[model samples]
Target: MDVIVIETPQLGDRSYLVHDGAVALVIDPQRDTDRVDAAAREAGVVITHVAETHLHNDYVTGGYDLARAHGAKYLVNAADPVKFDREPVTDGQVIQIGNFSVTVVATPGHTHTHLSYIASDGTTEAVFSGGSLLFGSVGRTDLVAASDTVGLTHDQYASARRLVHEAEHDAELFPTHGFGSFCSSGPATGAGSSTMGEQLTANHALTDADEEHFVRDLIANLTAYPSYYAHMAPANAQGPGPANLQVPESLDAAELTRRLADGEWVVDLRNRVAFSSNHLQGAVSFEYGNGSNFTTYLGWVLPWSDKLTLVGEHADVEDAIRDLSRIGIDSPDAAIGTEPHAVAPDAPVASYPRVGWEGLLEGRAADDVLLDTRRTDEYAASHLLGAVNVPLHEILSRTDEIPAGKVWVHCGSGYRAGVAASLLQRTGRDVVHVDANFDEAATAGVSMAELTV
Candidate 1:
């Protein structure tokens, strides 16, 4: 038996194709099924089955298309009875293809209809545990309000422990998610596969721990999930289905600008840090896989007629388009202009009002309001002599709280200050983002201290 794992970057998703002789089975395919088809054909294998571990909330699923295109049988759980066309996959139910037999195990928790499939060829052993047990963390239990999460998590933990206890000690575990994938929090920089024994020994969540500690730890590390996942479950059940992700042709800048001006959504496919620093004024920054989380957000925020224009870094056009296509977006047009010239060649360095010891006397001479946007704990650690706190996220929520007449906003390295400055500017408040070069001001005997919000 041969097993191949395809890792979709940005989203940290993995798809697998396992075959024996000339028959193959695909597991948790992404939106684009051409690649899977190509691989199967190259290996002289006919794809006979497509299995979805569960209705996914991350990227779009390709089960329907893969099955239809290859005339393969689609397998899914009867418990969920998702509206998609699939031969129901139930607990202990086994399917044979070539020499391999896969047995279904109902593992619920992350979502109500999750599954874990154990596959063996009577020689090598493995389990395509969809979202159940990732390398370090279990799938997020909060994907939905399924039963009592606390109880569900407990049940999940117990079920996972069963996998650990039952699967062959040397069975290679192949999951549909990797490190960067939201499905797990394991370091995204490591190897993709691990033996079940390794997870049993090293996985923090699976270690010997009481149920309460495990549940608490599970909830603590989860970041705010992508804002768009709320709609994926229903869409997957209804089978909006997948599309062929063809490579997109590049567009010139003028075409890009035209599209945007014509109300097309411009999705900036760049890293978060790069995107945060500089980008086209109205372009929405969503790095590939991560962008899908915000796709629904973009759909609602922007009109449907808005065509998507891609802005990629380092000439990563194809990579950007491929990532976008995974979320049901297909064949977007590229910008129809030259590379963007330096807008602010010598963009003015951000600046703001400064204070000094002489300035302190000057402040005493003329009362000046010192503003800070660090966390409250940071503020308690240290603060400017007379600065007031206004945490950044809440700034817009409580605009009335920021003093009207005069306020100087400063954060660690001026990044937060710039964000705050933009927010304040929108609200018609006079504010300047401070440069991080406060040391120069302090060197000139300026009185500087930390401030928290």
Candidate 2:
């Protein structure tokens, strides 16, 4: 038996294709079916089955559509009230494919209906613990509901224990999240892969016998996830069509200017520094990078109601559209150009100065407001003195909370600072982006409000 792992680094998730040289089963695929289809063809196998551990809260799942295309049995949890038709598999159900058999184990706490599957091909057994049992942790328990957090956390603890007990002694573990995914309840080890034996000693849920301690620590460590996550499961439930990776209609300078005036979203996909140096007025800088946290941030800050447009070099624009598609933002209008001024000729040009923490240490005016654009927990742990904490996700809604002064924006990393800088710049604020790592601030002699770990 060969289990091929498909990594989607941008979202910090993985999908698996398990085959015995002829028929295959896919688990937790992303919205892009092409990647899954390609993996199957290359493996020289036909996709006989597809299973979703749960309706995902991050990216749209390709399972429903992928199953339909291949005429495969779409195995979703029997309890989930999904809109689409599928082969409903319940807990302890064994599915015999071409050769191997898959045993479903009820492992709730990623979601109420979450399940983990153990597959064995006569000799080697592999456990597909989607979001339940991660590399060194488990999936976050807060996603279900605000009130369900405490209850679900306890459930998460039980789920992890159940997975280990049910699976084989030396079964190789494959989790859908926790490479860098926010779905990880605690700090994952960031290892590529692990076995049940390694995780038995290393994992928090397994090592620590006290369930209450595990629940408290897991909930306390759980941070904010993307606002876009709210839309994913709903989109996934409806069983959406395949990703629209086609290049969008190219917008000229005049049309682009008109779109900006209409208050449509016009994303500037350049280097954050290059974007801050110069960009079209009202264009938001969401600089596309490798691993392109492109969807995570863009999907968070922007409204679903707005018409989205992309402005960048041809390749970057193409890549950005594909990145956005997995998150359900498809076929955005785009303008391909290296020169921002030329792309939107009629639009006013805007620029903001980006400096390091040293710049603030060297010369910070008395009237300047130091804006810390990190999550609340991050700010509370440690932050600069007199820094007003307004998270990046809350920037649009909480603009009025910002004090009247020259603003110096900073985050744990400069990427968010650059994002805040552009939004603040568009609002006509005299903003200076402190594009430096937060670790440099203390060493650079910046006064801290608190240093409690």
The number of the candidate with the highest TM-score is 2
Name the weakest run of 10 consecutive residues (lDDT summed) in model 2. Answer: 289-298
Overall local distance difference test of candidate 1: 0.66
Candidate 1 residue-wise lDDT, 1-453, digit = tens: 889887676576889999996899999998778889888888899999999998887777878888988899988788774776678888878889889999888888676778888889999888888888777657777777645677667766876787777689799988786546655642322566788888887766578488788777676555545544665677678775566454566665556556545545666555434544555554554444433333433333333344677666435556656665565556676652212343222212122343333543454323545667665655666656667787654565667887665566666545445455545544456554453533354554556565444
- Model 2 error, position 87 (Å): 0.6
Candidate 1 deviant stretches above 4 angstroms: 185-191, 244-265, 268-281, 284-308, 311-318, 329-334, 338-453
> Which candidate has the top score in lDDT?
2
Q: Candidate 2: misplaced stretches above 4 Å?
A: 451-453
In the range 370-403, model 2's lDDT, one tens digit per residue, is: 9999999889888999999999989999999999
lDDT of each: 0.66, 0.89
**TM-score for each predicted model, relative to the true structure:** 0.71, 0.97
What's the distance in Å from true for residue 14, model 2?
A: 0.5
What range of 10 consecutive residues in model 1 has the weakest lDDT sum?
Answer: 343-352
Given candidate 1, what's the lDDT at residue 101? Answer: 92
**For every candidate, C-alpha RMSD to the true structure in Å:** 7.0, 1.3
Candidate 2 has which clashing residue pairs, if any?
Answer: none
